[model samples]
Target chain A: MRNKFAEALYRLSRSDPRIHIVVADISPAGPMNEFRKEFPERFINVGVAEQSMIGICAGLALKGMLPFAYTIATFALYRPFEMVRDDLCYQNLPVTVVGIGGGVIYSTLGGTHYAQEDITIAGAIPNMSILAPCDPAEATAATEYLVGADRKGPCYLRFGKAGEPDITKDAIEPFRFGKLRYLRRGRDVAILSYGVTMGLAVKAAAALADKGKSVSVIGCPTVKPLDREGVIEVLRSHPRVVVAEENAPRGGLASEVKSVAWDIQARCALQTITLKDEFVHCYGSHEDLLAAHGLSVPAIVAAAGG
Target chain B: MSAAPRRLANDFDTTAARERCYRLRRRILDVSQHVSALHVAPAFSCMEIVDCIYHGLMRKDESGAYLDTFLMSKGHGCMTQYAILESHGTLPRSALDEYCTKDGLLGAHPDYGTPGIAASTGSLGHGLGMAVGMAVAERNAAKAKGRPVPTIYTVLSDGEVQEGSTWEAVMMASTLGVDNLVAVVDNNDFQSLGRTSETHPSFYPLVEKFQAFGWETVEVNGHDAGAVFRAVTARKGAGKPFMTVAKTVKGRGVKYMESVPIWHYRAPNPAEYKQALEILEKVQS
Candidate 1:
């Protein structure tokens, strides 16, 4: 998945001179080496200065360039709130902030690198579009969408480290900003999910279908300006909706779905499969963290009362 | 004429330029009082700096021949900027009255949509980076079109230096040899929390620090309009960015408010406002 994201960035860099990338001394680790090698003049390694990297990216954007600043999700969002608000969003600059190792992807790095609060923080900023791709294809699509979009605003693209399932094929429809993709159809319950958890939700829905339960799975690539209509339509038909995400339950997709549900006064059962408020006490990989957080297929199914 | 006295005469004559600065400051204070907003101290700190940059340093041209762009990184001090713009005749005094009011163009911060404001900044640590970009872009455009480079000036807060983002811009400006860019720090010594030294304790030997970072540095009393003007107009060193440390009082011109931390977030009451007005009026008179 990381390779696919990197490949898309590499391909995009060829055509756009305005597309620049700033790395936090982690380009090689973030799988952005190809981009660095290809566009050496544009790529900047600011050592360990995440805050400064964000500022530099804002500066680059001010110079009529689109900068995709990359860093671990935790440091990028937490350390540079003022820069994100003042430089990028307030000015409405076209700067794509890519957060790798989102959620529990940095599980081995323990609590320090966990990016549980990125979506929440990014969502709070007005005019900031948030994208959490389900897989590499979606990630590539997001990159292309951001590069070509006319309305240049701040965007946060959150992705994991590597080795994720390839749920999207090349034939899949081109990713549209602020639009959701309906993967499967059912009437009994709707599975609304994004990012890596979309795959988990799909697996859970498939399992429920085998047991004679109807299920629908919607992959929400864009979290901000969320597909309210799609979510409402799904909720209007299905009595129960399960929102699953790799991030914390608070301020994640689940809360957004619930907010939509509440606005419409829908009485359907809404379940969320997400991380609890507490940090993961154990050390492991992304899968282990998800499992511990009850974000696995079986756990999601159990949460949905299947 | 004696050399020292002649220099002093030239320097003191710049005070005549303070009429515009005073008007700007008065407008800013009036707007803040009307809206009940608390930014008068920060606003006053940058009034002379902004006035000197726009009126003294920049050359007026629709073609943008001289200093093409100016940005206020310390956005909370927008009143100073508003005053400068009004004095420059780009923005009218009527617009200054609408500051911080609902549906008004002037908010507590500098905005790009506001005429003459290059970038909008309220959140600290953003303006300098944008200024650096503007300078780089101007240089690139000049190179592409085979024209002389235009200067870019960014006004920043002394407290903003505590933010790592400012240093990143500094590093980039130095490494890229952005001699066209000039960053002026309004060294008022006070941030949101009392004095900066008591809180962060980072001693900024600004000239030495920036010199080490490959920038030509100058330290001046920010309140001295002539010194600020001179510092800004000084020739750029070869292949190096420029930084000016403008030593200033936080709540300048107001007797009770000068160097006081309370003014950082306090809007003067009716009595205090009257007192402030009287002090400023005395200076003007």
Candidate 2:
């Protein structure tokens, strides 16, 4: 997913001279090296200063330049949160904050690198658009939409690490901001997932289907400006719904679904497959951590009444 | 207020500038009269510095578009910028009258979207980094178009410099060689409820710190518009970022309130307000 983001950004920069990449002490490698080689003047490495990185992005936006601020999800959103609120969102600038390795993708790197609370923080800021693309294809499409002309105001693009296969199976819709896309159709129950967890959601839906339980798989790429009506419609139609995510339960997909469900008094049994409130202190691979935290396909399937 | 910004003469006019500063000080006091709490002292400390920038330093082109940008990073001292913006004709007089009111556009902090405000700042340690960003963008854009890079100016408070982010910005600015960027620290020696020197003695010798950080650094009397102007303008094309530590009185122009920490966020009582006005009137005489 990170590689797809870099490639998509590289492709976009070919036509848009206004696109500038601002990173904080992250070394240039792979596609980034090519981007640096092609646009030496445009790539700014602020040298491990996250706060300054955010401020500079706002400054660039003020000068009519579109800046993509990239870093680990934790640093991108947590380190300079005030700058995100004051400099970018407050000004409603067109600065795209690209937070790589969203969720516990950096599983072995410990809690400091984990981005369990990015959605809660980023979603609360006004004028902030969030996109958590599930796979390489969606990641590419999301990057293009965020940095494209008619630029959206102050967006947070949350992506996972590389090598996730396409979950959409070439049945992708033209990427729409703030709208939910469905990958499977059923009636008895539905599983709505976003970001890297969409694969697990697809697996869970298939597992539930095999057990003779009709289940729908929903892909939520646009996290903020959540599909409120879509959420309500799904709640009203299904007897049970499961909102799955890699983030904390407090303000992730489940929180949005719960809030929307409450607004119209929808009476569906809503369940969540999310990270525990505590940190994943154990060291392991990303998949191991996900399984340990009850986000494995079988766990999700069990939660979906398989 | 004039409908268009009144550009000051090219030559430095100390006496005229002094007179303008006094009038602006008086105007700022008048605007803050009805408000219950404000950083009048902080604003007064940077009044001359901000006055010099908007009136004497910030540039405009033949099309009347401003060539340079200024961010009030020391957001609490925003009254100074607001008053100057009014005089610069960027804002109407009515806006000043409605300051901090329910229907007013103005707040304790400077918010972006107000005419002439490039960034919303009041949260300390935010403005300078944004200024550095603006400078980088200006330089990049200029290099792209083969034009001269426009300067970016931001004012910081003495106490605000204590924030780690401020140093983060300081380190990044010089490292990037943001020569088009200029910063003026309103060194009034006071924090919210204490003197910065007493609260944090190590913060002293700021000039040497900035110098060591790879910047062209200087210290000046912040209240002297001419000195502030000379020190700041001297850094143009200096090939490095510049930092001016302008020593100032916290509650300048109000004799009894000057250097008084309690005056940091207070509206003067009737007697104090009268005495403050009398002090400025005496300076006018």
Candidate 3:
């Protein structure tokens, strides 16, 4: 996912001169060396100053450049929340905030490093848009879309680290930034998933299909605008609706679904297979954290019963 | 000790500008009178710093199409900028009359959509970081177009520097060697309820702090617009940025409220307003 973001940025930057990448010491560590080697001038390395990095991007955006300030998820948004809100969101600048290794991707890095609140925080911001591509292919597509996006407002791009395969059937087609894409077609239950958990959701959907329960998988890319119509469609159609994400249920995709889907009502059951409000104190790989918190495929399958 | 150049004795009319500063104070007092409450002392402390920047170095057109950019990092003192901008004809006289009202153009803090405001700031410790950003963008855009980089200026409050983000910005500015950026700290001794000096004296001797962080530093009488302008416009090597420490008095023209903390948020009563007006009106010459 990191390499996809770097490559996508490189590809888009080749055509768009306004695309500038601002990093706070992520150059030497992240997959930005390709971009750093090519456009060293455009690639600004602010050197471990997250707050300054955000401000610099807002400044660059104000100067008619589309700046993508990249770093670890928490450091990029959580640490510099005010800069993102006031300098970028409040001004409604054309700044793309790419937060790498989102959710529990940085497993061993502990609770401080994990990004469980990105989508929620991004959603709360008035002029902010959010896109969490489930896989590298969609990550590339989301990058191209946001960089070329017509809206010149603040956008937060949250995606997981590399090595995950495509979870959706159509991974490389033209994608509308704020529209929800269908991953699998079914009838009994609707699985609305965001970020890496879409992989889990797809697996759960397949498991339910084997059990004669048809589950439709909806891929949520732009969770802020939230594909509200799509959420309402699923909520109103399916007998069971399962909203899944790597974030706490309170402010993640589930909360957004509820905001637009609750009053409309589902036919039978409404459940959220999401991270518990408590911290993931136990750590191993990213998958281990997700599994321990009942987001395992079996748990999701059981939650979306026949 | 700025080592850039000093024109402390330049022909920038101290008498005339000081008189304008007095008029600016009266205008600010009048505008704040309409609003039930105002950040009077905080605004007064940085009035001349803002006035000198707008009237002295930033002689750009209203379009701001060039490299000269200014952001009020000390956004609470925006009444000073609003009043000065009106005096400069950048902002219309109507903005002052509608201040803090529901239908008003102006608010407690300066918003970017408002004329003469570069960034929305009321959140302390946010402006300098953004100023550094604007400086970098201006330089980058200029470099892309083969033009000379534009200079960036921002004014900050004494209490605002207490935030760690300010030091973070300072360190990053020095590291980047952003020569085109100039920052003026409105170092009034008082903060909200206490003397900033007594609250955190450790941050004092602020000149050494900037120099240690690799910036060209200077100290000036903040009320002296000539000194403030001279410090900002000084010619220094184009390697590191510049920060000028402008020592000032809170509630400067209002004798009774000078350095008084309550005046930071409280509006003056009718008699107090009359006395303040009398203090400023005497300087019409």
Candidate 4:
């Protein structure tokens, strides 16, 4: 997924001079060396200055350039929220904020680097479109969509570290902003998720199916300006809906799904599999955080009563 | 001191201009009091600075052409800006009365839709970047169309220097050789939480810091309108942005209010309001 995202970025930069990237002295760590080498004039590395980098990107966007600000999710979203609000969202500039190491992807770095709260913060901002793709193919699709589309405001794209399994097929429909794709269909329950967590969701659904329970998995790549109609369709068809994400339960995907359910008067049982209120104290890899948070396939299957 | 006073036309008078500054200060106090807004201290601090720009630096006819470009990045001091615009007849006095009210264009911060307001700002650390971008754009557009470049001015609060974005804009402005840009920092020594020295200390060694960043720097007493006017009207640097560190006093005209931290947030009550009005009336008298 990381390679695909980089390739898409490189391809987009080839045609659009307006597409620029601001690195926060962590381009090599964020896997953006190729982009730096390719577009030197368009690439800016304001060393270790996360807040200023975001501001500079906002300024570039205001000057009629489309800037993609790259950094780890923790520093990208939390460190410069005021800049995002004032410089980008307030003016509705087309600054694409690309956050790598989302969720537990930075597990080795512990809680400081973990990006479990990105969705909550990004979701709260108005005029900001959030995209968390399921795989490399999906990431490429999202990149193309954001670069080419005439968006109303700024956007945020969250992706994990490299070498994730591909969940999307080449023949699938082209990605659209705020649209959902039903990866699998069943009758008993609907499994909804996005980002790298979609892999767990798919595995959980397959496991549930093996136990004689029909489970459907929906991949919602876009989190904000949510596909309300798509969510309504899934709720109407299934007796229960389970929202699984790597973010906190509060104000994340589950919260959005709940809002939709309430508005449409859907009586389906809505369950959310997410991180608890307290921070993770144990130290391990990304996989450890996932297992500890009960986001693993086996845990999700058990939660679904399979 | 013996230099001839630079005049706009036959009607320009130093005594009249001084009187206008006092009137402008009064309007700022009234509008701010009515709106119950903060930043009154900083707003008062920048009155003469604004007056100097409107009367001395800006060319009346060319000012209208550059309306789409001016940005008050230090948006907290919007009352001063409103008063200056109203005095210039660019904005109506009624709008000042409706400031910070619901459905009012004059927000506590300057908004884009308000007459003569270039960009919406209240959020710190954004105005300078926007100004830099605008200046760069003007330069690019001029090159493309073979037209003269438009001037861009951004006002910065001393507290805003703590924000890294200010430096980012500074770097870019220098890198791009943005000669048409001018940034004025209102150095009133106070921020939102406390004094600049107490909160986030900035040792701005003004000229050295800006000169190192490729800017032609100037220092002036912000209250002295003559010095401000002279500094702004000076010749532009060769392919480098200009910066002015204007030393100012928070709550300049109001005697009891000057240099008081409470004035940063506290709105004037009826008694204080009356007293402020009286002081303004005496200045006018």
Against the true structure, candidate 3 reaches a TM-score of 0.94
In lDDT terms, how accurate is model 2?
0.84
Candidate 4 error regions (>4 Å): A28-39, A170-173, A209-214, A262-265, B1-23, B29-40, B52-63, B87-90, B112-115, B129-151, B162-180, B190-206, B209-215, B229-240, B253-257, B260-285
lDDT of each: 0.77, 0.84, 0.80, 0.77
- Model 1, range A1-306, lDDT digits (tens) per residue? 667777777887787777777777775644478777766657777778777677777777766788888888887777787778777887788888888888878888888888877888888898788998988778878877888855468999898867787776632345677777877777888888888878788789889998888887788899987888878887888888888887777787789888888999998898877788887877786778889877788887886679
Candidate 2, CAPRI quality class derived from DockQ: medium
DockQ order of candidates, best first?
A: 2, 3, 1, 4
Give the per-residue lDDT of model 2 (tens digit) for B102-162. Answer: 9998999988889988889888888888888888788878887888678888899987798
Docking class of 4: acceptable
Give every collision pair in model 4. none
Candidate 4, residues A1-306: lDDT per residue as tens digits? 877887888877887777777767674533356777876656777667667677667656766778888888988888888888777787788888888998878887888888888888888989998999989889988888888865657888899978888886732445678888877778999898999999888888878888899888888899988998999998899988888888987888888899889899998888888877668767787768888887788877876777
Worst 10 residues of 4 chain B by lDDT: B1-10
* TM-score of each candidate structure, all chains considered together: 0.86, 0.95, 0.94, 0.85
lDDT of 3 at A213: 90
Tell me the deviation in Å of residue A279 in model 4: 1.8
Q: Which portions of model 3 miss their true places by more than 4 Å?
A: A27-31, A169-174, B1-11, B61-67, B281-285
Ranking by TM-score: 2, 3, 1, 4
DockQ of 1: 0.42
TM-score of 4: 0.85
Tens-digit lDDT string for candidate 4 (B93-206)? 678777767876667788765788766788788888777656655565565467666667778888887777788778877876777787888998876676776665545566
